[model samples]
Target: MSNGNEAGDRLRVGSAPDSWGVWFPEDDQQTPWQRFLDEVSDAGYRWIELGPYGYLPTDPHRLRDELARRELTLSAGTCFTAFHRGDVWEQTWAHVRQVADLTSALGARHVVVIPEMWRDPASGEQLEDRSLGDGSWRALGTGIDRLAKALHEEYGVHLQFHPHADSHVDTQQHVERFLEMTDPELVTLCLDTGHISYCGGDNLELIRKYPDRIGYLHLKQVDPRVLAEVQEQDLPFGPAVRRGVMCEPPQGTPALEPIIEATRGLDADLFAIVEQDLYPCAPDVPLPIAKRTREFLNRCGAGAR
Candidate 1:
């Protein structure tokens, strides 16, 4: 994990269930939680996120035991939000509380907050406007600030806002606006390389410009050929993933070595979580890719310490 830095200064690398083709809490097509835990550990990763909340066990005690059994530590729990809709604080908090509680109870200090997609990721059905109005923008910023404050004050968890594809906050401009709208003290960016590249944003530029906002990392890459096809065909994220748009590292755009190097310069310890969107994949698919990706990250100076 050395690129001119001490062990403590290196980014903490981990993987999540998304790499194992999980997109739901309980799906017949998804990998079983127990096997996911086993395979992720077998792939040589020691940290993980609570993907889709219930995809892993919800009981803190049971989950803690399971992780301990495998020598795995919890990185963060992901929760979705739709603050731009306005006046949904209670509704939003109700959903976030469960994840925040479990995340806090497990001693994980971060909650990855994903903005709800404007279009349904599964069906590509339009759900809301792709663009936000002024009022909606204000609502989004205010809501996220309030949410972050609440999560921190109540659960002692930092909010790492994730800008997702097909969501209002997908592009560089949108992400910048998001950062400006919320309190810097309360909201930090979970700079997901795959989604950033998928939406045509520059990961390196974003990191260089907003080093302080770069709180977490999702190491992913997009296949230029498939990405070009997806964009030309106006394909939805679900179909794009199935088309192999998000490829394994070193086989896609935005070579991770430089990104890892840049984060090292930030001088703050960060979690570099490997995540590839392979939802609805064969159960046999993830482990091999995970192993290779872990090795790849190691070569990039981002492996486990």
Candidate 2:
């Protein structure tokens, strides 16, 4: 194992807006956009991934000014698209292009894609064990490859496929199968520690098994008790997240030390973006955790130095 106290020379730390509890404008009086950016800066984060589009200013100049004020650079932007079906991608491609243009203008190099579902999260749909037909699987791979190449060649953004908990590639076997179908050179894994763990995959093992395939990361930690509840009660993705399943680094299963250790010797520019999916919660709840998480990464010897 790579030393947890000295996690190699290249690994750098960053964060996402989900860590700050501002997923959407859920509350009447939500936290200000500047507040999240300020806290990210105050917490010593040098990079941040754009959460949902329009969560931050969609206008490139305004967004650039906002980030420049905080000394934060755009790490990447998340694009949750249903790339499995061709017609869906036609509608979603516009959103992807907008985000790609924005991220590229901001000098962010990654375009993170999550395969999406149409069902309601509140419906408690269990998708982890599902499998697609052979032709559907091939179409999925082809779609990802095409999107990856287009995003890379046209937008100057590398495409990273995030195997999320509620997505088609939820389980370890599914993630393995997805990678097997796609071009390794075209599609890279945007590993999410919490989602992988929540879906019953070993994040550490996956990182070790495919070091070369990992191009980006969501440094999320999953609560073991919360995951147990999710499994036992058939909880939906939103409810599981709202249950504080993905929390600060020190308070979770698959302990972050080992996970962080597993990330050594990958690409130098890889962004281990800290992402705790806080939903419908107070901004106060995440502020202290953000500070502690950054400090914790530094102490663990995994953060930007």
Candidate 3:
């Protein structure tokens, strides 16, 4: 259950190998994809996650070739805007299916789902209304059930639900309700540390409660004071993201000890991807964060599976 020293080489902590994975809107210097790949490769990471930016290779052959050229492997890819509106469910499914096919072809096993833009009926807006009654949870569960079935039966891909800020499923109660509603075999959870902690949940407890169901992970840290500010202002989730409230793992204030211990007994294959939404400022900013996270993981000494 632990990825000890022997397995450390396989489950080693590393950066995502591309700024594209972090997706900074301001950092649009128009650097070539090859240049980005070279920088990431030089940073001591062998895996990379694909972003939906212009730099991401859409064509399967081109994507594979680019990754091979850089001697890096595709770790996973993000798929946002799925299951937003009831009418677009079919369309969303089709688009995600294409992504799954691409992931399989590119040799990536996980597909990260961020269901933003989903309307909250009470607010009649894109932002989620946490006060929505129990009915809302039921509806969400049914929708995720359908999507989970499709992802497994149709595309042979695993569905990893990300409980993001401003999204309907952001809080601990929502996550608990979601797990209660969906089938664990088909629908898996992606523990996003920053978002969960920001929304006031003990993420480590959630991970422990559903060890087998966690298929992927986003390792991030947040300063508790900044998080409190976002909650106090009732700020929209998008702005919080823009303000750099979410950051690289092992920084800011969250204590990762519980998370480290919770992951000790998990038998599932989990990818602890270091994702910091900082872009356009400096490329080297993430290096120290990565090194510190690796040291933390090493100190945990649970990497001996």
lDDT of 2 by residue, 1-305 (tens): 23344463456688888787765534443567778899889888889988878778889999999999889999898888765655566777788998899999999989989887534454556544355777777778888888898898898889999988777789999999998888988889999888888889988778777878888878888888888888898777888877878877788866776667766656545678888888767768878888888888777677574
Candidate 3 yields a Cα-based lDDT of 0.65
Cα RMSD of predicted structure 2: 2.5
The stretch of ten residues in a row with the least summed lDDT in candidate 1 is: 1-10
Superposition-based RMSD of candidate 1 using all C-alpha atoms, in angstroms: 1.4
- Candidate 1 TM-score over all chains jointly: 0.97
Off by over 4 Å in 1: 1-9
Total clashing pairs in model 3: 8
lDDT for each of the candidates?
Answer: 0.90, 0.80, 0.65
Candidate No. with top lDDT: 1
lDDT of 1: 0.90
The root-mean-square deviation over C-alpha atoms between each candidate and the true structure, in angstroms, is 1.4, 2.5, 4.3
What is candidate 3's lDDT per residue for 1-305, written digit by digit as tens? 23355334335344453333344312353335665667666655667776553456778899899879877787776676534344557777777777787787888877778766444412425544444456655656777778778777766777888887667777898888778888888888878877788888877778778777777777677766667787787765556655667765456645655565566567865676666555433545655555555556665542412
Q: Name the runs in model 3 displaced over 4 angstroms.
A: 1-14, 17-32, 53-55, 81-84, 117-136, 279-305
The backbone clash count of each candidate, in order, is 0, 0, 8
The better-scoring model by TM-score among 1 and 3 is: 1
Error of 1 at 228 (Å): 0.5
